[model samples]
Target: MSVSGVREAAAIWARAKARRDRDPEPATVEATAPGIRRRLDLPGAKLLLAERGGRPVGFALVAPRARTLELFYLAVDPDAWGSGVGSRLLQDVEQHAREVGREVLELWVINDNERAIGVYERAGWVGTDEVERDPASGRLERRFLRHIG
Candidate 1:
């Protein structure tokens, strides 16, 4: 996915997140678009989309840092849950990190998203248990890390 694909990919992320978030007010496309565009413009930032029968079903956004690759966003369509889309997206992100020589992969998940946390944990992501409030939604989020390369 490229900068031209931001709007579609952002919609996939927003919709999937909305279905899974415990918070009453989920992120809206209007609010997430600008940040998605900014990230798309960043050097070393890559977006990967998963499609089923040519229809977009998931997306992952990885932002490369000095020593780590941040899995900035990963989401699958709610309808595609339990179909391995999330797992494949995460795996692809790790492969990308390895290709870039990143030592680790990092991502933040809302503290209340147990399903997502479980997915990451099963994939060997270890959480430091540190929590921070998201400025946009005031939701508590936890950071997870895993050595990748």
Candidate 2:
């Protein structure tokens, strides 16, 4: 989506985010739209969306983090969770990252989000004990990354 559409895009974000806490500010879709889009469009950033049957089902957002590509955000429609959209997005991004000679695909996940962490691990992502809080939740989280060919 374009920057102008950030407001509309915010609605989907509200639906996509799995609640980590009872925070209301981040959940205010309209307010977070602009900043979220700005962050995604920063230098060396990439955003990919997954659509099928004319509807957006997933999105993957990336940004440069030192020598790595940080997966800043990734979300699949709860209804499409097991339909391979997430995996496809990852593979597509991985290929592009490799073509650009990126050393790794890094991302941070909430410690409580075992599902995503497991998915990444299965995709060859390794875990690091170094943890931090997602500003939105203040929950303990860990970083994961995988090297590409």
Candidate 3:
């Protein structure tokens, strides 16, 4: 990711977090850039950039966490929302998770985010009955996971 991409991600995250008015983990993506980069550089972590016919479009960053692969960020350009970019990115993530021996793939969906919740559930993700308060926002997020062989 370039410095500009990091800036863009931060801008996007700001809008998202502010829209939710969530509790508070570091709201700025740049604050987490170092750590994000660390994980992206890790052996089992994968960063996938979504492109349409060779044009960059979006990004998804995944990391192996113990027995599961964590979907860190799945960002799609606003202009590309209706396309299959997000779906394709997710499928690739699932495939990578399975190849790495992860029986489960996990992601945090912000509570009250009906759209994302619907998409994940329709994609076969189930809630884990766990609520985590983001250190940055203090709002609680429900954990969701999908099991894949």
Candidate 4:
């Protein structure tokens, strides 16, 4: 993904988070763009984008960690919710993990984000009892794993 693509993904992330969480004050692209770019710069990190009609609708970022792939981010534009864009991006994430020789994919999702948790569950991710407080948002997050081997 290029710089422009990072920006687009950032916008989608902000919008989706705001809508999903019903945040009165939503984060802007400026707050997220730099972080997305930084993740893309990480060694072995892969950015997967789902586009429709030649426009980006969703994106996922994954990086290799030991024998597993850590999913750093996954977001779909609010306008595209319920349209299978997130599911398609998730399938690509799994394919990328396999291409990189990883057998497991892991991610952390906010504990109260039921919609996202449902999506991950439907995609074969199993949640663990482990939980952590996200320092940035102070929200509890739970770990989920998918074994693709």
- Which one is best on lDDT? 4
lDDT of 3 by residue, 1-149 (tens): 57665555544444444444554543566664665576667667777777677655766788899888999877665556657776787888888887888989999977877766776787788988899988866878899999997
Candidates in order, TM-scores: namely 0.89, 0.83, 0.76, 0.96
Error of 4 at 123 (Å): 0.6
Backbone clashes, each candidate: 0, 0, 10, 0
Clashing pairs in 3: 23-137, 23-138, 23-139, 24-135, 24-136, 24-137, 24-138, 25-135, 25-136, 25-137
lDDT of 3 at 122: 74
Candidate 1 Cα errors over 4 Å, as ranges = 1-4, 22-30
Candidate 2 lDDT over residue span 1-149, tens digit each: 57544543455566657333434534566665766687776887767777889787777777777798888777776677778887888887797687667878888888888777767887788998889977866788898879885
Which residue segments of model 3 deviate by more than 4 Å? 1-32, 41-43
lDDT string for model 1 (1-149, tens) is 55447776877877777787644555676777787777777788998989999888988888898778998888887889989998998889889988888979999898988989988998889998788999987999999999965
Per-residue error at 80 for model 2, in Å? 1.0
| Candidate with better TM-score, 1 vs 3 | 1
lDDT of 4 at 2: 80
Score residue 4 of candidate 2 by CA lDDT. Answer: 42
Order of candidate numbers by lDDT, starting with the best = 4, 1, 2, 3
Candidate 2 — number of clashing residue pairs? 0
lDDT of 4 by residue, 1-149 (tens): 78888888999999898998788866888998988988888889888888999999999998899878999999999889999998988899988988999999999999999999999999999999999999988999999999999
Off by over 4 Å in 2: 4-9, 18-28
